[model samples]
Target: MGCAHGKCCNRDSSTSDEHSGHHQRGIRPYKNKDGLTQRSLELVHVPSHNFTLQYSSLTQHGYYPDTTDRENQDSFCIKTQIQGNPNVHFFGVFDGHGQYGAHCSNFVKDKLVEILSSDPTLLDDPLKAYNSAFLATNSELRDSEIDDALSGTTAITVLVVGDTLYVANVGDSRAVIAVKDGDRILAEDLSVDQTPFRKDEYDRVKLFGARVLSVDQVEGLKDPDIQHWGDEESHGGDPPRLWVPNGMYPGTAFTRSVGDSTAEKIGVIAVPEISIVRLTPSHLFFVVASDGVFEFLSSQTVVNMATAKVSYTLDFNACLLQNNATAYKDPSDACTAIAGDSYKRWLELENRTDDITIIIVQIKGLSNQSVVGTTDSEVHSRPCQTGGSMNQSAAIVPPLMHQKPLESVGHSSCSFLSLYIYIYLSHLFFIHCATRLVDLPYTWFLCFATCVIFFIVVPAYIQPLGEESSYYLCFLMIFFSK
Candidate 1:
């Protein structure tokens, strides 16, 4: 419905100055290690900022809903130390499909950190590094056969540098940044869902003119190409219109993504533009949450919830109230301090909620705030109003307090590890049972060996980092299975 009259979400992307040199670096390149290829990692440090950061994820039915994870593949996480880079940290969501998000996670979890620090030039141009990594990963996928193609995963990662937050995404996975000044504003949408009708997705669809037609508009793809003559003056070229079946829209579903190469050639879509934004204290908080969380709540509601937390406190404990008042001297319970019940509003406001995942990030900002719920229409609308200073109506915020790091006086690191281990054990047990809901084929089981081998090459330093001539045994397995 967005591009009915044509004018898809197109961008020159040139006029806008790319803060970090935008000279089309070669597509991302990848070199596999012995037993692995793609990987992602996370690094967080407290450089005198009051905040609590955490992340959680859940799938449709707990990974492959058809297999017993206890005896098979499982999801993983890696935390690495960046010697010189203290403020630079990484957070990623590698969502695997077909088999499970584990393999995809494995491939990227191990490499994300190394790639970012690989170049001495990274600090000067993280965007270049970001683009290269994506191209590098996609290039590796090109070598695998079609079956492996179906096994591809989407990636969404965030990096926080003081006040600036950058995100690079591939596929449907997404990233959200919530800011709090006086009021809450969705500072930026690091990534779009890649759904067909979204404005920015228009050009990608028009690019896929006839191929989608060959599939016969089964999904949302259909006959496009309408003359978009805007008074024959303002606009001239043939504006691409959304094609439909029975002359109706909603024919094709996804327009752009990583694994949809099969659709890209038929004039379907192209890769998505990496999204970026810098943060300020004006907004209350920033949440790098996933769609599961967004699907249920509007950005403003999230801000309001955080703000109400501050307004009510209106007063600080005598001892700590002194110079720093932004958060509880202890930030872990920051959310608890702000929202007494912890997003209780989500339950009452949203139409629905999935595995709500969020990273509660605290920054410098004003104290006056709003209490918006997930259902607030304005919050659900464009959470972040684009362009810079023009958004004055939004809450004007200044850092409320100076900062201080919490002192873990007698905390035992081992105890924390043990607690997490126990919790993870319980989660794994439940996920194992939940996986039985989806029916998988015998081929998926039989090709396990081949699948293992293919995944193994993802992280190792294999040459070319782009194309490959290998289509091993699993290639044959794909044909037999179908």
Candidate 2:
């Protein structure tokens, strides 16, 4: 594990300006007691005034002793006006897991952007370049002395050139955009989570004789069924993951990643899912974060939280303008505020937090003048209105609040009570006529059909009501069926 910082450590970083030179010199290289050359790096602070692009990034370590070690396995980099290309802006977030996870993430953070920059095809075909860079980086890691048999990293990158935004992802790290549609803010996921749970990933892995197991499946295995490291029983409530047949040599959660040579044999790949989006004026901001922030929050939750931060900053700026205040803050403050909120929410969800990283890209304006002038009122008023496609006069569906648990307001108490009574009556009927019911010609079929109707079919049909409501319905179905 290594220390977590917001920026990258470049051994050969060129100083283009006075600040770059100062930044380079301020980073002093050191060696640990183990005598390994530690990569000394500083978080690249892109102040709102001087930054070439509109983006902000933050990384925080997980809970307690994990926080104490500061071995944040997440890393990100933002490069604007890359290689004399003024329109090109690149942003990435990498999440690494395993013993030397930090090294893997750090290596990708350092080299991936360089590879992308150097590729001649980047300007001509950005998607191909992004893919090539990721594969090349994976090969580089495999050939290197780093032990990647059980270790690897997940990456999600955003490359915005001109009006086109290209998002490429490998593993569970995520990317999303806050789209202003009318008066509601909508979260459009730009990158998919490449884990075994996905239908495509599951099918592909199974084709290679690999099995995706749930936490319960792994814990339930006996001697011949499976062999795993750590406790034979479940330690913590682990999630569903990819595992090797009859072995748990590399129990990677994700179906796609970089530099897991051993897991590659079982169909784990380094290929990334790439998406291209044409930016519009209605597009509010872009958010890229590791699973740490997402694990405890939904995409909409993140967008709302960030939108709130943007609103707060807008209000603060308005007051500052009124007073003609000398001291001002960068728009990046919105990103820092979101990260702080994420950490607080994580604490509420779980006892231990994973490493958290968030990057916010302001899309409406690239320069300070336009961004600072943009107020909260404009952004908040239209959450669902897209550039030219969507209607403006549509009734606003209130933005999903992330701060608290959701309750179903659409369902009335009377309806719930009636439904409960109906279920109770069915249960009583089933119990009273069990013997007679079994003698009927299609008795087994009837029972199976009824169970499916009450359990699977009904829940799926009413899922639009809300998740909490669906969950309660499922509980009732189970109770009545029993």
Candidate 3:
């Protein structure tokens, strides 16, 4: 348990001299030779582009009950203005595993983004650049003196180019976007986890001669032939792991990662699962975090936490009124809340927590843009496709734009027209009643009640319900009340 790689090696728990404690700040405040800030953690405001992105990140060292002193294997990077392009930005979270996992994570954190930024076709063809950059970085890591035979890091990165987002992921770290559908905010997964739980990944590794089994089966404590694990959430006490057919030297839970030479032979490649999303006003913000945060929490839970409303008091003539506004919270506060929640959950469940890192980016002021390329439904419905080998044209994935809130199913033009007709008929009926009814005040009261129900109660309820059926119900209520 003292070893970072656990059963992979017998080495003692000795922290790296270069990365002792959590001193390595991924977003350092140093300037490069060209006088550009290499990385930053402060608020970023890009005026040239239509949108303004403010981001905050937090990384906490985990509690290791077995070891007195252990270095945090998590690392992250947030670089802005890639290649001097203000509209282009980068954010990544790296969760390292194994003895030298810290070193692998730090090394990849610096080199992978650098290689992608240096590529000339990054803007024109991002998918190809991502494929090349990840593979290149993996090669560099293998050649380096960092003994990544059984050690490596999972990478989840997002590159913002203008209004489009290029999310590339390896391993289980995840990225999720908060999409505002009417009054409700929905969570959308930007990247899929590459693990044995995924049948495609499990099959791919098995084809590469990997013996996928839990430690129980490997130790003869359980049946080796039967597959026990279902999903990550219900994997019980032991999850399925990948190991060599003849040996249990390298047992990696994830299917793809950077470094992990020993595991690479068994199908753990560094090729990233790239996703493209076009930023819209409805895309409020996105969260990129390590598996430590997502291991116990779902993407929807993370998004909900990040976008949770905070109530504040407003003084009006000394009368304190509670205001529960859904305005976006400060990115810094959001990061802290998310990390704290993940930390609490881990300790509550496992007694020890894995290193947790989170990056919350708030997107604002995105001008409505036309659907340029691949629609989100089309891309999301399609199976996960690995990059590289494809031609430049095939590799270039167009931006996936979100459908307008009003244009969604059930809330269409026809629905609005029907609603308008109902309102008009209701008003006419109220007028006819006004002339016939002997009690004019009662008729007026009824009209006022109808207005309040249709305008205030109906919208308030429908916004949270976020369904077309609710709109129709509101129309019916107004018609019957009249």
Better candidate number, 1 or 3, judged by lDDT: 3
* Predicted model with the maximum lDDT: 3
Order the candidates by TM-score, highest first: 3, 2, 1
Q: In angstroms, give how far residue 375 of model 3 lies from its true place.
A: 30
What candidate 1 gets wrong by more than 4 Å, as runs, is 1-83, 99-102, 144-146, 183-188, 210-253, 264-272, 302-357, 364-482
Rate residue 69 of model 2 by lDDT: 35
Q: Write the per-residue lDDT of candidate 1 for residues 147-228, one digit (tens) a residue.
A: 2222334456666533345666654455655443332233344566654335556555555453222222223354433222
| Candidate 1 vs candidate 3, TM-score winner | 3
Q: How far is 245's C-alpha from truth in model 2 (Å)?
A: 0.4
RMSD of 3: 13.6
Order of candidate numbers by lDDT, starting with the best: 3, 2, 1
- How far does residue 265 in candidate 3 sit from its true spot (Å)? 0.9
